[model samples]
Target: MPDPIRDADPTIAAAVESERERQESTLGMIASENHVSEAVLTAQGTALTNKYAEGYPGARYYGGCEHVDEVERTAIERAKSLWGADHVNVQPHSGTQANMGVYFAALEPGETILSLDLTHGGHLSHGHHVNFSGQLYEVEQYEVDPKTGYIDYDALAERARAVDPAMIVSGSSAYPREFDWERIGEIADAVDAFHLADIAHITGLVAAGVHSSPAEHADFVTGSTHKTIRSGRGGIIMCDEAYADDVDSAVFPGSQGGPLMHNVAGKAVGFGEALEPAFEEYASRTVENASALAAVLRDRGLSLVSGGTDKHLVLVDLRESHPDLTGDDAEAALSDVGIVLNKNTVPGETRSPFVTSGIRIGTSALTTRGFGPEEIETVAHHIADVLDAPDDDATLERVSESVDDLCESFPVYG
Candidate 1:
């Protein structure tokens, strides 16, 4: 093959090599990102990418899909076993597309969709005015309790009743605490609305039984395969058998065209890895590391959403502790020292999304790289030190050195 990528286009090859080096050198704390396993990488890089597997397993719109059909079937079976869903569709191109499939299948244009406010941790696809979900549907938003930094089910129920929404969306991008799926299900039942739980951030945790599954409660469940799942990069939808055909049709003809069979193979590989006992430990330690990080930050006077984390990420509200330091400031300072994460908007955000008042840190990638609570605690201290004196060169140098040492010890790709 003469190393096609390197021999043909050295430009892109260099960029890919540079990205690999970047991942190896820095700490990745982005809540929605993870390092997929080598098996997944190999699978995604296979010849499956050349296949155009349009439509479902047996009934495809394209020819020469037998092997792709097997790969996708394996993915769907693994997903069903992992989430206990009656039907699974591993076809949507991304989580946003998966949400679109559900909406297109179930709701009419201009029907009401009530979801968490974007500034309060909800995703843009849930109904941000700029997204198609918002433009096509009547959107209403709910917020976390300002005092407690948790979803207010009472207020949510009240809103559902007052609005009489057609669907209620649950799940978040930055929330730290676990959702009460059962209660949310009851609320949806009370209002006669469909409950669509987008467990994009917590997919692996739910699969590992570390978090509660929405499969039994929500009418439609959507997730990104890459986030906590360590899959290549794609989306999935799960629902009862009654809605299976509609979901499949919506995903194929309505939202997306050919399914990415290479990614589907990647998902199959990753889902198989998750079925092992070690993945359960990885999921558990991910949560434990987040808890340790939360404690370290809170002890240093930074306010954490919900006081602590019960999942893989922690949301730090920097308003009270560092009045002048915005989330953008913290993100840049941390990035300077090779700790990569994101600036996020906190509940009751006073600043714009671009210059928000909080930072969201995650542990799944670190945990995947063999980091435990002790190493994560050390990382947390480095974060606190950097934030304490962001402008100090001496402090930045010290933390930078520490990050280098940690990266050497963990060795993300070794």
Candidate 2:
């Protein structure tokens, strides 16, 4: 190998190298992010990227897709095995695109859609006004119960009845607790609405059986391949065999063009890795680390949404604990010390989305880097220290030093 990138394009090569260093140096606590294995990285950087696989396996519009077909078929079969769905489509570009495929296949234009409100831990693609789903569909929203920080199923059912929506979306980006998918499905059935569970953030947990599978409860399930699964950057849709063709068509001709065969190959590789027994341990440890982090933060007087976490992440509502400190402030303060996470809006948010009342932290990436509860506890202490004394130079310096040591101990790419 001649190292084509470094030889041909030093600028892009430097940027890529710098990004690798950044990931290797910082702790990735963002709920939606993960560091894929080298196998996945290598798979995604293969010659398949040059192929134009415009359609599904064995039936493509273009030529030269036999190997890519095998890759995609492997991905689909592994996905079906992992999620226990009757049908699976591995072509959607991202979780949002997968949702779009489902909506396009199931709903007419201007039909009503009921989903969780954005400030209440829902995604923008779920029904935010700026998203195409909101612009094309009549949108209604549900919220978390303010006192408990959980979805009020009764209220959601009542609202579903009132709205008479065409589809009801269940799933969230930042919710700390598991969903009652059966209850949501029953509500959708009562309202004659299709149920779409976008389990983008919890895909791996569900796959590993740590979280309940929505495959049996919801009409359609959508997830991102990258998030908790570490299956490269892409999306997937699962449904009954009846809607498979519709979903395939919607994903291909309706929403996107040629599929990314390189990513599909990556998905195949990652899915195989997840099929191993070690992956179950990874998923379990991820949740355990999050719980440990949550306990440490709570002991430090930080208020958590839903009181705690059942999955790989925790949502910290800083309103009561640090009235003057915005989530943005904590995020920036922590980032300055190389602790990376994102600001998020809590239920009944009082500030703009840009300046939220909360921060969302996850253990999936750190878990991928072989972190356990003790390491996560130390990271939690570093987080709390940064947030506790954002303006104190000495404290920041001390936390930065600790973060550097932690990153050195658990090298992300190693």
Candidate 3:
């Protein structure tokens, strides 16, 4: 290990050590998070953060930007190469900001827009009344089929045609199926609206060729570097040449001022890492683990939305098998035994979004930690035990032991 940074900044260094201990001890089952390499962490703590390169590479508002320009340019090139995008803007700060930049470039305030319903797996920026997208624009929502628990393209098209929105946002925060990017683009074209695909959760899948790439079909695409990509917390926007200037302007002067060079450097490392041969196998294993986990739940007589998952996440319907348990209770119960997941709404859920009827599980964190299909199934069985008998001391104890044993086999950051 390198020398402890504690010698320089004891305050932050202590916090870092505490976080490291937390990670070493806990099981991370969150769908939206992943562990990054030490190299990525080092890039984030570099001296690049001290500079004020408030503008793009050469066209900076300050001096001493020769080296920082290379960092930003390398990030931009790697992004473009990864997705084959004509234009790449690597300064949005987050996936939400990437979505916002696209929206700001394409739509004016008060314009009608088509987006997915929040409770049905859509992101907050897609049109939640509390989000800026909703506060500034008129939103028309579309929902999935009540029984199928999958995206209803026919209904989405109907709503898009009815609303005649200026833009159509396609993506989700908790959706577990592959997106029909071409169908979404067709709908956007039929309604004469701009289409943006928010592939934040599936960016790694796209990069690794495990899922459909929206960059090839949509007018614009946005993604995050932290999720399945196993990078830092950052956002990126990819667009065609026709919209390059507008998109770049929207990201820079129109939205944020200076880009986070350290984060961008980390993004470059992640992009470089993704291009390696091993990343494809890692991503494929992630999907396989998700499917394997889902199979265990179904075999145990638990209902899974859409029957099962096609990617790295599964939505288990608590209303069916565990009728007495609410999503909130199940989440807390599972957490008690060291398992983690977010409570989410199913298509036909009668409960509110806050107190949802389902829990969303992903295998990204576990897959990155080196768990394969067999291990994933074992963990899934343990999760079922924890959920079915949260109050049983023996059951919780057994499940906790299983979790510890599994993490022990695949120790993180050791």
Using all chains and alpha carbons, the TM-scores for the candidates as numbered come to: 0.99, 0.99, 0.97
TM-score of 1: 0.99
lDDT of 1: 0.94
Candidate 1 lDDT over 208-239, as tens digits, reads 99999988889999999999989869899999
lDDT of 1 at 404: 97
Q: Which is better, 2 or 3, measured by TM-score?
A: 2
Question: Which pairs of residues collide in model 2?
Answer: none
Q: For each of the candidates, give the backbone clash count.
A: 0, 0, 0
What TM-score, to 2 decimals, does candidate 3 have? 0.97
lDDT: which is higher, 1 or 3? 1
lDDT (10s digit) by residue, model 2, range 235-260: 99999999988998999899999999
